[model samples]
Target chain A: MEVNEYNACVREWADALFRFACKCTGQASDAHDVVQNSFEVLWQKRKEVETGKAKAYLFQVAYRKSIDHYRKKVKITFAAPPEETYTPANPDLKKILDRALAQLDDQARALVLLKDYEGYRYEEIAQITDLTETQVKVYLHRARKILKEYLVSVENII
Target chain B: MISWENYEEYMMMHADGELKPAEAQELMAFLDANPTLKSEMALYDLTRLTPDESLTYHDKNSLLKPEPVKRVISFPKWRKYAIAAGIALLVFVSLFKYIDTNKNNARIAKTDTTKPIIPEPANNTSNKNEPQPQQEPKSIAATTVQPAKVTHATHHDIHPQITHNKQLANTKQNDNALVNNITPAAKATTEISSLPITTTKPLPSEIAMASPPMATIPAYEITPPAKPTKRSLIDRLPIDEANKRQLKTIAHITSGASRSVSKVKEEIDGNAITFNIKNNNIHISF
Candidate 1:
């Protein structure tokens, strides 16, 4: 894609990338860093990227950066507050839901985001997650089942 | 009325949104009969639709922002090495020249005289001359009448006074022969002896007298002074009276040798006036 076109796409897609990074790290600052780093990588290798495939390329970089951020977090053993902590809770449902989401493994959570939040097809999720399509379907199914069970438990407790 | 085999296909198709209206109707018919499975499907749909509070997603467009990369520049290996080597070579050459020039100058300044400039008067003129037949009359006239004038400057390794006495004899000889005859021996003695014993300054005539003394001293000292015609010859002379004895002795022996060789069959000629005379030794030329 032309640089201007690529830039427009980045502007359009930055929120979504931030959201994904926010999901992965559960911290806005870490999400911002991951998204920023991914874009930098994309800009560096933009010439090699196909115009139609730039979106996929960008997601791939962001996903990698997000994973790296978590890995580093784990290595350093830093404890970050859940994303919903910033929301002043009228009912505290958001905080409860966020705590439940954070409890999921990194891969399972990424699969859930790719499937439900981004509306990626099973095949595209598999490509992004480097899993088989069947695996992607199975994982998404399981992730949803787990979320349903956890949310029900949380609601009952509330 | 829905069999378990049909139930799996029904739920799978519903989840995928791929059910035909009739197939969906059949699934609903099955679900309405099996209420437990219906609740499960409803629950799954709700779970899928509900927003994840903790999660935020970024699309590719959002993730790609431009940043600048800095490049590192470096100098080439061979060029740097060549420059270093050139500087080292220049320093080495300059230092070598400095040491060699200083050593050479010092060696030249302290040099002693071993080389000789042999007086080759025979080379200048080829002639046979005899001594005057009235040798006694000449001696009586030269030595007795001018005892203070005829001086023979003879220097021995032991004493300088001997050379001074010989110089007195040369003055006496010249006193009888010609009042104006400037005998080098008498001139040097008279000029040197006239100066205060401790004074270092030499009269102009003494300087002239000292020139011949340098010739007798040695050949090595002659090379440096050879370039400056006036100062070189005189400069080679001993600066101190103490060293003059050695110089005069060397001169006396050299002049004596020349006189003996040239004295055979000498007759009185205007140009043949003898400058060298020792006991029973005379040189004559025409």
Candidate 2:
């Protein structure tokens, strides 16, 4: 991709990539880092990428960076109790949804983000997450089941 | 195909908008038949996350790159070579002109120094018939004598007296007889006879010194000098005192050889060798 096309990708897809990173990483700061790193990788690989594929390329980079960040966070804080991880001052629907997204693993969360947030097809998500289409469909369905269960839970729904 | 075992997959695909329209209708019909599963499908619909429009990357300007600059002018290979060749030719022509100018200046200086300066004679006597007394031949140092005011004289006009005296000296048997004929007054008059004589009027003193019979002396002609030539310029250059001594020594040697040669030739064929020291010319009678 040329510079202007890469920059156009940034303008069109940066917010969506950031939201996907935010949902996968579960922290605004980590999401910013993931977004920044994803664009940096895209810029570095601009010559190899085409303008049509730049959005997918960016999401792929952000998905990998988020997985790495999530792994590092898990390794460092493995002893911490899951109940103490999120303490929302005011629990709204968006905060409840965030807590439910945090319950899924990094890969499942990225699959959900690519599916719902970016509206990528199963095949495109499989390409970005480097999984087979069947794996993506199974993982995304499982994630949706977990989110449905969390929303129906009486304590969490309130 | 929509059964309880595979019902959740249809719900997820329907929520993701991946199901075909007929399958979506089939799932809705199956949900209508199973009234309790209708609420389960609604919960699946809630799983689709709507992107918050307020969420944005604030630092997106940093990712943009500037456009590449365009070149204003470019030269072809032939044009560059032509420019270089033109510069080289201009320098070569300038150097050649500079060298040629220097050579011309040097040639002018050399010509000025070697040019002969012909001057008029002090005594303008040009009497051709009178036998003038011969002057004692001076060394080459006498060449530096100051020139007279008159600008030019031919060899015949200037040296008529010398030619007459030479013929007389040739006829006499003894050199002392020729020396006795040169009176003291004539000797004084001919002191600077090395200079050309241009005047045609005869002096009273020369008429008195003409005691020898003019009829006995064979008439000889001296050629006149024309415009100065290269040989004349070389002859006019001043010789140093040392060079004059060397030339005198060479002249003495040559004179001795000439005397011996004269005697031998006179005995064999009545011909003689005559050497003139004043002008460095050798005459041979054959």
Candidate 3:
């Protein structure tokens, strides 16, 4: 890829990648580290990557690095629910959804974030998660079922 | 055709908004017929995670800035020179080894060296025909060239001179010349004139006949004059440059640093000076 094209990739996708990493890792610092490392890896391998495919390549590297980062953080902190849900002028439904998202596994939450947050296709999510399309569909269906049940429970409580 | 019974995949695709335009029309028509499923499918969108602008980093300019490309591996500067030095040392060592082995091979091939040949006893009865002058080197060469002497390596040195001396001996000036000429075998010998000749009783003629008579005599007199009657007083001696400087320094010291001729001469007349010059010792008695 040309230098300008690669630099454009960095400008265009840096925020999207940071959002994905931030949503996956749930920490500003860890997400920052993941995005930085992913972009650094992309820069190192920029010559081999095409300009059009740089986003996918960056996501692939970020997905792997974020997964590793999540695993390291997982070991130190058992999967506890978030201490407090930071709600900012969001409706109760959005708050409930945020709480439900915090309840999902790192992989499931990342898959959901990639799907709804980034609108990645099932195949792209499958590539990022190292899963078959069928498995991605199955797991995403399960994650949606869980979130639906949580939403239903919050509605009944209200 | 697009009902949930036959193609639930199409329904799920429709829920994800993955349907193409024609499939979207069919899915909308089917969803219009089944009004309950439309609201049910809307739940997928309601549960979908929104792109929270708060979550998306805005100051990602720091990240968006281009880092220097790191594809090239930079080796330490010393590594290039070290590799070059290693190759040069390898070549130099190989060259040295090659030359060393060849030198050993050459040494083995050419083992010949020049060794002085000595003559044998002069005072033999059957050697009455032996010329007294040629006795030293001739007897030595004859003995060495005899069947007992395995060292014929110097035979080249003996051959040319032997041929020349044999022709001279063949000239036969007188009986003295005849006696010398009779020992034609002596002409083939090296000149061993520096060695003092020793006389012993002659062996039988049988042994004398077995030896060659050639000898190359050096031009110096075969015998030295008798030893000096007594030591004589020496007047002066010539020395090399270093000793000459030392003499000047001694003369200057004794001449009250003037180094004047008469004063140094007076200093020299008072002392007996002994010195060695050109391997000869001289003693001056004042």
Whose DockQ is greatest here? Answer: 2
Question: i-RMS, every candidate?
Answer: 4.6, 1.3, 2.6
> TM-score order of candidates, best first?
2, 3, 1
Model 3: per-residue Cα lDDT over B147-201, one tens digit each: 2232322322222222334553343234234435645556434223222132121
Q: Which is the better candidate, 1 or 2, if ranked by TM-score?
A: 2
| CA lDDT, candidate 2, residue A48 | 94
- TM for every model, in the order presented, reads 0.41, 0.47, 0.44
Predicted candidate 1 versus true structure: per-residue lDDT over B146-264, tens digit per residue:
22322321121112222334665465455435533668787676455332221222223333344465346443131222354464342467577566666777878998978866763
Fnat score for model 3: 0.48
Rank the models by DockQ, top first.
2, 3, 1
Q: Candidate 2, residues B236-272: lDDT per residue as tens digits? A: 4599767766777887899899997886566553575
Off by over 4 Å in 1: A75-96, B1-26, B49-286
Q: What DockQ does each prediction reach against the true complex?
A: 0.22, 0.46, 0.27
lDDT by residue (A47-129, candidate 2, tens digit) is: 89988888889888998998888777635221212332223454355555666776787788788878878889999999998
lDDT of 2 at B33: 91
